[model samples]
Target: MNDFKSLKPISVYSTKQAVDDGYLIQVDQKISQEAGIRYPVYLTRAVWDKYVEVPEGMEGHQDQSGRLWDVLFMFAFFGRKETSSHLLFKLRVHLPNTDNWEHNEKVAERSNRLLREVTLKALVTAQDFDDPSPAIFIMKPFED
Candidate 1:
């Protein structure tokens, strides 16, 4: 059984800094304090830019052997909600534990597939995103 241990609520919003500086992933403040990690953690360039956005001049964008077509691909894949309840969970679980993200293409591909499957299932089971006791759990008290 593919038992997901817990879910992490993710809020992806646009900020001038994010657009200019690159993608940012900020774990909820309270959760970070509890987890003993930094708050408003900025995604490392190596981690965040593993995939680049497709330029306009480019004829088409394809998932290369060792590249992703930017994080927007992820948003599109996950149904583009303002609040994604288990995004961090899906990312942490699906992403392979490799120092080099590109080293294991097969593993990365598999992880992506699994994350999608689990996220979809959770969304379906939850039915309403605003339900107090949604099937997918939030990682922080602030989120409630």
Candidate 2:
């Protein structure tokens, strides 16, 4: 077995930086061409179990691709485990449609709650891997 203790902790690379590096255009383009509204979310396999879990309400109802994850699972899991693999998650998010202040406020409130409720570590992927390797964890906002 690989010595889990010896592998380097993953690194966190911002999505903006990835775009600036010109390494994410192909995936971004594919996202745009296939689904107009869905954005991308990613996480490595080493940390996947931490951030995702089946809630009681949606036990067996969720389809494989459409399953729901604990909102803070990623943050909580990665904060504890250390590994060298760079796993990527191609998930999507659907923000509220209406621009009403109250709705937006609620959204911001929830985001803050998650941030406050969970402590996120500065996690990132290793750089020596080949092109198109998975990142540690990142969620790109929906682009119209």
**Per-residue lDDT of model 1, residues 9-44, tens digit only:** 586333334436654333244543343322232333
lDDT per model, in order? 0.32, 0.34
Clashes of 2: 11
RMSD versus native structure for model 2: 15.3
Encode model 2's per-residue lDDT on 1-144: one tens digit a residue. Answer: 788879875876655565566443223324322433132434333122222333334446543233223333343344345454332222222322334222112232454422212222332443224435433343321211
Best by lDDT: 2
Candidate 1 segments whose C-alpha is farther than 4 A from its true place: 1-14, 21-44, 53-70, 80-86, 89-144
Query: Considering every candidate listed, which one attains the maximal TM-score?
Result: 1
TM-score of each: 0.24, 0.23
Q: Give the TM-score of candidate 2.
A: 0.23
Give lDDT: candidate 1, residue 48: 36
Question: Which regions in candidate 2 have their CA more than 4 angstroms from the true location?
Answer: 1-41, 45-47, 55-116, 122-128, 132-144
Candidate 2 lDDT at 94 equals 30
Residue pairs that clash (backbone atoms under 3 angstroms), model 1: none
The deviation in Å at residue 23 for candidate 1 is 6.2
